[model samples]
Target: MTWYRRYGRWSLLLSWAPFVGDPLTIVAGTLREPLWSFVAIVAVAKVARYLAVAGATLNLI
Candidate 1:
């Protein structure tokens, strides 16, 4: 929560993956109800952000 308040979504992602545990088992509380969790939003947002950024860069190139 501190990280989320501090660095936003990126911090959340790092917290989820955390280099010492199994991602498949981490859960991160997103898989609870599929309609109410920061995890799903964060993941989707990150992916969308990357795609948007990539598209912009490609257009520029």
Candidate 2:
């Protein structure tokens, strides 16, 4: 909780990352981060991650 209080918003930028992403989201819920803000940020992060992956795959192909 202390870590989240300090780094929560910054960390949300990486909420698209695997492994750590799920825990970060759970902690966000436990800490009661605002629903709209959480969804907006996480949605952006996830979309960015997928776009990056798609770009990389296309480049490799």
Candidate 3:
């Protein structure tokens, strides 16, 4: 089975991760995931990651 067949939409959550993010985005395109959903999911994941990093930094300071 293909990556899409295995992971499906859940894989989009990893699109904001480092190293793997770019490739995951490419996979999403190759799989023809809907633009709106892709943008929305990726945006949310990225924002959450940013917030977590910011929070950790502030706590360390």
Candidate 4:
């Protein structure tokens, strides 16, 4: 709960982290974060992660 207050909108970025990312999403909901902000942040983070992984895989191949 305290973490929610501390993070505010920035908490959406936590959604990209490992294991704890899921729970942070739940916390974001409870904190009433802006829907569009959460969507946009998470979308960008996930997309970036995918791109990085793809680049690494291509390099390895």
Candidate 5:
């Protein structure tokens, strides 16, 4: 609770982490983060990660 809010917006970035990412999402829910904002943050982070990986795999990065 306190830990999640402590990080504030930065916590949204943690959604990209491996095992810890799920917990961070749960924390986001428990903290009642703005729905669209939370979705946008997580989606962008994950999509950016996948795009980076795809680019690297294709030797574009």
Candidate 6:
């Protein structure tokens, strides 16, 4: 009985790491200024991360 058993979806969030390097970077950058830039970077990182996940999932299928 692990935490993930109750929070399975959390694994998908961890999947973000392949593109988004550090959590501190995201938090620190968002805190700084230029909010749109932070959104853009996060968007790109998420897109890349999804594509990678999709590729792996497809290969598994």
Per-residue CA lDDT of candidate 5, range 1-61, in tens?
A: 6767677857787687799888888878887888988999899888988998999999999
lDDT of 1: 0.48
Clashes of 4: 0
Writing each residue's lDDT as its tens digit, candidate 1 over 1-61 gives 4433455433444433336223432444433423345556567656766776788989952
User: lDDT (0-100) at residue 56 of candidate 3?
Assistant: 95
All candidates' TM-scores? 0.37, 0.88, 0.83, 0.80, 0.83, 0.51
RMSD of 4: 2.1
> Cα lDDT of all candidates, in order?
0.48, 0.87, 0.84, 0.79, 0.84, 0.54
Q: Write model 2 residue lDDT over 1-61, tens digit each, in one string.
A: 7888988766787799889999899888888889999999999999989998998989952
Name the best candidate (by TM-score): 2
CA lDDT, candidate 4, residue 20: 74
- Pairs that collide, model 4: none
The C-alpha RMSD in Å for every predicted model, in order, reads: 6.3, 1.9, 2.1, 2.1, 1.3, 10.9
Flag the better candidate by lDDT, 2 or 5: 2
Ten-residue stretch with the least lDDT total in model 4:
7-16
RMSD of 2: 1.9
In model 6, the runs with Cα more than 4 Å from the true position are: 1-15, 18-22
lDDT of prediction 3: 0.84
Identify the runs in model 5 with alpha carbons over 4 angstroms from their true place: none
After superposition, the stretches of candidate 2 with alpha carbons farther than 4 Å from their true spots are none
Clashes within 3 Å, all models in order:
0, 0, 0, 0, 0, 0
Candidate 2 positional error at 43, Å? 0.8
lDDT of 4 by residue, 1-61 (tens): 7767876777777676799788888877877788898889888877877787898989952
Distance (Å) between predicted and true CA of 57, model 4?
0.9
